[model samples]
Target: MTLALPPLVDHHCHGVLRRSPDADTFTSHLTESDAPAAPGTSFFDTQLGFAVRRWCPPLLGLDPHCPPERYLERRRELGADEATRRLLRASGTGTYLVDTGLPGDLTGPAELAELGGGEAHAIVRLESLAERTADASHGPEAFVEVLDHAVAAATRTAAGFKSIAAYRYGLGLDPEPPTAAEVHAAAARWLDGRTPGERLTDPVLLRHLLWSAVRTGLPLQLHTGFGDPDLRLDRCDPLLLTDFVRAVAPYGCPLVLLHGYPYHRHAAYLANVFTHVYADVGLALSHTGARAEAVLAEALELTPFGKLLYSSDAFGLPELYVVGARVFEEALTRLLDAWTASGAWSGPDGERVAHLLAAGNARRLYGLGPDPS
Candidate 1:
């Protein structure tokens, strides 16, 4: 019995490449690792690499699990636009909540929506907004005024907000909203020594950006668990965010923890305990491939159905979207099927819960409308 999930509301993702990528560039997007694969082992030797070769080829007019070289050759032949179109359309995602934070030669929300044959909404990255604000404002005081106004303005259009505080100053930082004095001093110090286009990394300023977004009452997505080398994995655990999660609870802002792999269970535990907390195995599921079922099982252990949302976290590659969706749906179907077969869950309950994970949870959390047809 298939799960027959609804079209997904991909609640957290990023845009695909704007131009055709060379082999190395394309493979780079497949893993969280920033470095190239070891000389003998290809990035294609990984689970995500295998998953893409398996799931994406059939969509691109080839047999499943074709050689990586063949897949790239065919992709080049089809061209980026055509390849991206075929893959995104086959993904079965109806709506995209795109993070417009990462800098690259990538599509914007509107272009991605059109290419994927779905509607798209923006999830403004708070740090990006603050950094841009800092770039324009000379004084600490003016920076505060400008950033506050920017956050308020973003709330009117963006579906949510995302913060990479985990990448900057670990999630272990003091969670309480920083006082204005601290914010001003931090801003002054940062701007004084900052080079052009320097990222926002100060702990105090990160707290301020977070609090400002919280004040907007938008659902805030926080990056947790695995990422590039910039992150300290020891510090990326969601448990480290307990104080901040608890502090943000009163403001009624939904905290969506993204890419919680090794820590997905902890994230689920947070969702179970906190009314405003939500979690997704976005980047994890895509990267883990065949092992996504184990990840999903762990995520489901403590999370309520309504608190688990669907997301691809696919960045710079449409194939990631294809593999992400396929792995998630397959993993979820197998999990629910086994449970229902064992009489642990009723058939109707299993169906309903699958739908919740696919789209319902995200719709409610983000206050989105019905999924696209």
Candidate 2:
């Protein structure tokens, strides 16, 4: 179905780099060399971005000799051009949020700005203190430095920072999994040090960071629901955030729930109940099997009007934008059709729904102009 909606916004995407043309050759070499599979996995799945943590090596065309920074640097050297821009436009994405690679890779932001030419919107990823060290024993001093650097980078680029309080396990620089004490310690450190107007890791950190941001009235985005399969499903349960939502009900700042995957219904429930919490239908109806019409209908039934935002989370392949947009349109068409047949919504209401789903909600939420361009 053709959707008569505003240009779609891919609020979360990582299209800053394209896969190398020599991916197959590189994969073969890696398999033949010392980089064996991380147990129980085949070489083919490894090459196809199956294992989340190890996925970046092939996509960035990294040689074992090169560090990740250098690999991303090579991607920047290739850069986004007219053909890449065409690919994005054809994919039906008008705006995207590009994670500026990892810490110290601000080149992604420059590349996106050059490519966009002020025609599209982009949000650059800033490094968080949590990403600084894999170990938590180093103390909060280093973390404080990382946060300062992140704020400085965001200030320099007119971009926002992305933070993560806890990954699969612990915090700190150690590759070893983090313990519960480490997680709590890291959270406490972030809460104590963060100032007003700083970008947060995600809404899960809201309870700790909210009071600080609320004191400063800075906006915060929360990564809700599912993301890379490496993450445990239970950790992403939206219901786990009920206490968090209740805690910050008093001091308000715009809280965007990123992803909202399997928990779309729950996310919508929170959106309906809280003025500050809004559900972003970023990766949900796209990467996940939740894109079916029935899922969309259920989400719309649960979601209040104007609480939904569009996002792509388009990392790896740029084609994800088109794939995601098509899915969004299909699901939305089914929802409107069902609503119309039941006399629950009319043509005008459908038009409004389309507008809200497309850009109206995001424009208002992010305080963006009518035309992001």
Candidate with top lDDT is 1
Q: What lDDT tens digits, residue by residue, belong to model 1 across residues 91-155?
A: 99999999999898889999999999988999999998888888899788999999888999998
TM-score of 1: 0.99
Q: Candidate 2 residues 95-139, lDDT tens each?
A: 555555343322363455355342344443333333433133244
**After superposition, candidate 2 runs with Cα above 4 Å error:** 19-83, 101-107, 113-161, 166-216, 288-291
Cα deviation at 243, candidate 2, in Å, is 1.8
Instruction: Tell me the TM-score of each prediction against the true structure.
Output: 0.99, 0.67
Model 1: lDDT equals: 0.91
